[model samples]
Target: MRRAPIIAVVLALAVPSLARADIQPHKAIYDLVDEDGAATGGRVEYEILGNACDGWAVLQKIDIPKAGARVVTTNASWEAADGSAMRFHETTERDGQTVSRFRGQAASGSNGFAVFTDGEGGESFGQLPQGTLLPTLQTKTLLTQAKRDRSVLSSNKVFLGTSSEGALPLEITSVLSPRASTPGDHPELDGQPSWNVTSSFYEAGGRPDTGPDYTVRSIQFGNGVVQSMEITREGATARARLRSLDLYEVVECNR
Candidate 1:
């Protein structure tokens, strides 16, 4: 799953007509609840740093306390300034034991893109389709298209690699619409215009409706802040609410 839920999903929002300063660097916290309230004691934290001229840093941590299958997942990744390459590492711990870890990098290639991994369990190689996009660029594309007059955007390919197999391309289909907002603690976001973005993920090279691997629906604001998110898979859904938000001062790049 996109443990970063928000991280694996939302990134930068630099449209052609916008200035780079429009990029946002912030830290956010979300509390999670599964359908039926069957699971409690769950939380997700996300933070983003850097800019398009100096690469981007993202970190997400998810903790779920189940009776016996308690698990915590941490996802960290760095995308190159131009979105041409990226390095990612993920660690999953269960019941106090480090269960899995993956470290890898993907770069643009003559054909498309290539991925090499040497993690705790094994070593592997993977290839991304020619149109495949790294996470941040993928999100930028989502926001760009969402702002258009169209209501639905489909067939966008993105590589959201979470493990050694992270390079596999997933087709994305999104439905978007304008939304209203309410007053909130953070004035930067309070009463801001928002959009309802619902995206479905499907395996590449197949029919999307056969059954999407998963779907993500989020409340995205004009400034690119994802106020809340929900991820659904196998007919079950987990929801996360934005409980905290901190926008960082934009740092000028010396490069």
Candidate 2:
């Protein structure tokens, strides 16, 4: 699917976060592999938005394949709210794809974060049941809890319509912190990847909620182009080979 034009404009806005963290240059294609060294066949498209000085950030488009004719697609926007702040918004498309099955918004504040969404496609991450009280409580209650402790953890869970079999859930997790840095591979970046990044959800604990490990490493390419990366997932018992990368200019948006 083609990226929305609105994203094009957002991509061009330069901000401080983009420059502070030695993030890679914008616009690239990345592949997601499973533990067996086989491509999970999941594809991620990313682009840096704006100039590095403004508040550089990355936007990702994810497409997941299903068993038969069904395909799950998510358009995610990750913005560096400054050197220390980041926020995310995701819209999901499933089955036919024309109609929006689910839509959600999540933002992080100094203390913690909250997510809110109302849609039919609850099966995708972040999308929830209509008027679910716990989510609403999390929005108001969790915020204060985070502020009191100053350490917080939050994630998005999408619950599709229920069937006789049971409820199907999809999840997306994020770790927010005051001192998180960029991935270690890109030390030049102003910000480092958040420390102690762990993602998980309850089962009936199924495989759908688990994600592959990613470790980025810097590798020298014969060409002038430079990049770093690694993939390490305990479940997959696979390691991402040292691969070449291209670091692009990140644009920051003026808030």
Candidate 3:
């Protein structure tokens, strides 16, 4: 059900420094389940590292087990610094055997962003429209725009990097409230601003009312940490809740 792109739906800021100034470097673990509260035999582990000067590195791994002796695992790593250049790699495996893999890079060009991929025999490469953004940059932009406008709705086009398909249009709606107002397992996040965000990913230029190809709902911290998330497609829903969090020391950038 078009699950590859769903792995890139994590939240990140524009650059490391911007994120460091607001968000903290951290490692998070989440447990996955279904609507019936039954264990889906899925787990997710995410780590964000580095700073704006050295660039930001994001690593994510997800494992979902099926009824039989088969299990699907998706691993993705993304690195970007200053929005000028980006490198991404995603690999999906079934029952411990590689099923699909994508390795690519994108950079700013004179006209727009140029994407180069070595996937499927090095045939997937193209130029994105001028305003197109890589996933990490897009996330950063979304957070910046949301705070600037102080509104709940924002839209942008993001290059998935996994495929030759140009870009995916995204509409994000957020609800901001005090973290202390709600009750949850992570008391360390209390008193900070929290956001309940819903993001719809669709084909570029697709009408917003036409329904989204995929939708993800996440409860995220003001500093960009996602405490929990749920993804839905074709009436099937999967949920991920934070299990543990480790905040790293922030590097002080000399002004």
Best by TM-score: 1
RMSD of 2: 11.4
Model 1 vs. true fold: TM? 0.83
Per-candidate Cα lDDT values, in order, are 0.65, 0.34, 0.61
The ten-residue window of minimal lDDT in model 2 covers 7-16
Q: Which tens-of-lDDT digit does each residue in 44-91 have in candidate 3?
A: 777887766666777777777666755554445455556666777767
Candidate 1, pairs of clashing residues: 161-166
Cα error of candidate 3 at position 246, Å? 1.5
Ranked candidates (lDDT, high to low): 1, 3, 2
- Tell me the TM-score of each prediction against the true structure: 0.83, 0.41, 0.82
Which residues of candidate 2, in runs, are more than 4 Å off? 1-21, 34-36, 81-87, 98-113, 120-247, 250-255
Residue 152 lDDT, candidate 2, scale 0-100:
54
- List ranges where model 1 is wrong by over 4 Å: 1-19, 35-39, 67-69, 116-118, 148-152, 184-186, 204-206, 253-255
Model 1 lDDT vs. the true structure?
0.65
Q: Give the per-residue lDDT of model 1 (tens digit) for 178-207.
A: 776666535678755567888877765657
What is the TM-score (0 to 1) of candidate 2? 0.41
Which candidate's lDDT is highest?
A: 1
